[model samples]
Target: MTVTGEDSVIDVDPLEPPLCAPLRRDLGWAQVQRMSQSAGHRDDPVLRQIRATAAVRRGTRMTKVLSAAQVSGHLGGWLPYGFCYRACDIAHLHDPQELALLGTDGAVSAEVAYALRWRAVDPLDYEVPGGPAQPGLATLQAHNRVGAMILGTGFTPSTDDLVPEFVTAGFADLPMPANAQLIAYVPGGEEVILYTYQPEQHGWLRLAGPRWRGLLDTLPGVTPDREYVPCTTPGSAKLVGQIRDREYEAVADPPEEFRVRALTRAARYPVSTLSRRAEQALWRGVPCWVLQRDDAWARLRLVRPDNDALAATGARCYERGVYESWAPVGELADHHIADIPYVL
Candidate 1:
């Protein structure tokens, strides 16, 4: 593929193998740099000069490595919204061990790692940072502490190793695409797919078996025998596409990346699970999901609300059905994932 830049045109072999082998060890930022340079990854000027808005093709698989906290939050019902990368760009780094290197932001974490895998449903919601189209983005990044760190180190532990990082426009929380997967990277470099989201049924289909069922015990309200749990929280953004003169929910399910292991064979699990679990809780008297949290503060978004609830909390709308606010960690009440019944 020929990518044209302002000053030069570079040829990228469509079939060229991965730039490097899977990173084996969890290394610090300084060590990672030395390793990259020693491996000659920094010597390829084509990689450095390559600049183009990666096409957000429908059905393209996207992967976001999650921290241990993020994994717990998601299982506790937090919708994912933030930065992720196209799977193809980092195909060589998909191994569980290699993923740990990326998940910890290269800082080395002794805890278990996790990742979210979903498909691109709409092109409008995704954008490649520092691409040719977003010239000013680089300037904006330079003024921040994150940008300062990047400038001083010449490496972005989370994204720089992999090119063409994409973020959701406005960082808006989006609805979980059907069959979105939650994966666990255990100690022995094994990937345990814990659950798969079933949009049609509005629940998660548990995929883990005997050995890995122990992982479910950690999640509050999740049980091994219960195969599905309701998670129909109202979302802020959804993708709809018209087909055959009718409108319906649109989903991008790339066959290769959207399969599950069943017995001895891998196959696409049909979305027909029934919901069973029932539990709900609130934070500060409002049903909300914790988007992020620290010792002092927790960022939350409303799960389902009416006008009165919105007015009471002073939460601002991020999009339809999505409202968010920052609450003091001490003042907030215990929050739990709501298991509301599915309506449609």
Candidate 2:
């Protein structure tokens, strides 16, 4: 399906009130630090405010800036499933170059940066940190940041100036939402949209024009000529369009940020091959990407081979530079994709 210039734009009025007021009013870095040190109960006013401010309605656009490595992983068919913030919260950051630095910790990179965007499906999945429910977790994160600084790693400590961040509850991963976009921020402040997910076709539709097509070379397993690369991975969230009082899934006209002129010239080419990458899963409380699996056993590779992961799963390197072990299907926790959390 071809979408032209004005035809594809979804008009979102800037004045429209968001589902919930911005949390900045109720929570700040100061409040975060205070709550992190307090032994207050869950019903504390500050805690309640944090929870209320974090509430999101379905269809709200969420974004997560992607590192260069993450961009390659997505091109290799890794589903997005980690920390993301509501797009409306960061709307004030108009400069594409400045916005690109959100995920990179202000480190200017030689390579291009990217972002993953998807609409919200369920509010329960997102959680505001430093809330009463997870005070200890927040404290630990603060301590870790300080430790990093002491170790001369140049980690920025949380302060009153930073914005509040959220995480997927229990760090669980969600299925990619339909219409999720992979956008690239080039060096010269140009926001080049590379691909948009097509739910019905179950693949990413390459929308980068000739000028931007060169960026595809940086992504593994992706090329400019392959207009559609089939991905049958399941998605739980969807972009909803409303006409009058009726609602429909995967029918929403994309926002102006998502509609590029290249979309008009794009064609839905046939996909002759399918990706055979194994889905991500959790085993013995450790995250892993499946290498091979069957009804009873799964040959899994650890997502993070840190000491904690090794101790939790007893995973060992059977071959040089490869850490993996066989885990029974019954022992696996959740058969879901995992993304690296962007913690504050």
Candidate 3:
């Protein structure tokens, strides 16, 4: 088969290759660019341009497209071809067992997006337009069903998952105590602490003692690292420093080059929503700053330390931030800077 732009097709290429590779090759460029312009991906540039072009070719207004897997990480029965599930898969999410399949680390993260259907189970679990139904949501606090979930008889991790050992290590000894439904709650400002000395790294970073709670209302301006004043400094300062430290070896304020890339990309989107996302992405690496080069709409940067991250995020900054485009990253990186005074 031939893509619209490329005339040649490789022969004997199909010995039933991996699911994503074939689908990726066959997809129209528009979808690929949609992926780049999508969440903070930094995917292949060829893919980004093709997707971007395809998006425009369809119409002046472009809708982003992503592979099923790109939409989320691997799930029990999902593929680029079909049987897809979003990161949210609430049925899996509600149960700690199912939540274990989330990311490569299988650690608890806010990343998962429960399927819209799962909202029926607990409308309060997710944020809904006009602010999720807050009425009956209070009921989730005490009922035994609060954390209830359904799983396969012996749902063990498979090769399809990133964290095969997660289930065995995490809830294996979480004090079932007759398989209690709720894990008990700790009040706000309670200085809650949880720990383990397991010889595995599940999170992107590790900390020794109690870390600052990023949530303001819960701790009321308490910083994670008490080495520095908490409420006095903006959390954005710490976050920007953290991302830079991770993406790059050093931890300093973002440079002008970073901010310029952010501003240029944010220009591609509507400021009402994505500006904040653009600010946050500044440190990730440069974004797909679309500029007219020889009359062709192309990404300003060829490759970046992190690629395709900002565009899709930038796009999602619109109204609800569900479906993506490289918009949100651009928005956060570009907009949030104003709020972060120390970085200035």
Error of 3 at 149 (Å): 26
TM-score winner among the candidates? 2
Question: Candidate order by TM-score, highest to lowest?
Answer: 2, 1, 3
Once all C-alphas are superposed, what RMSD does model 1 give against the true structure? 12.3
What are the clashing pairs of model 2? none
Q: Lowest summed lDDT over 10 consecutive residues: which window, candidate 3?
A: 170-179
TM-score of each: 0.53, 0.55, 0.18
Judged by whole-model lDDT over C-alpha atoms, candidate 2 comes out at: 0.52
Top-down lDDT ranking: 2, 1, 3
Relative to the true structure, candidate 1 reaches a TM of 0.53
lDDT of 2 by residue, 27-130 (tens): 55455555533444334654444435434555667777776666656655555454456776555544555555456223345467678878755555565544
Model 1 error, position 221 (Å): 5.6
Instruction: Provide the overall lDDT of each model, using Cα atoms, as 2-decimal numbers.
Output: 0.51, 0.52, 0.21
lDDT of 1 by residue, 90-115 (tens): 55564555676545223334445678
CA RMSD of all predictions: 12.3, 11.7, 23.3
Q: Which stretches of candidate 3 lie over 4 Å from their true place?
A: 1-88, 103-344
What is the overall TM-score of model 3 with all chains considered together?
Answer: 0.18
Candidate 1 at residue 111, lDDT? Answer: 47
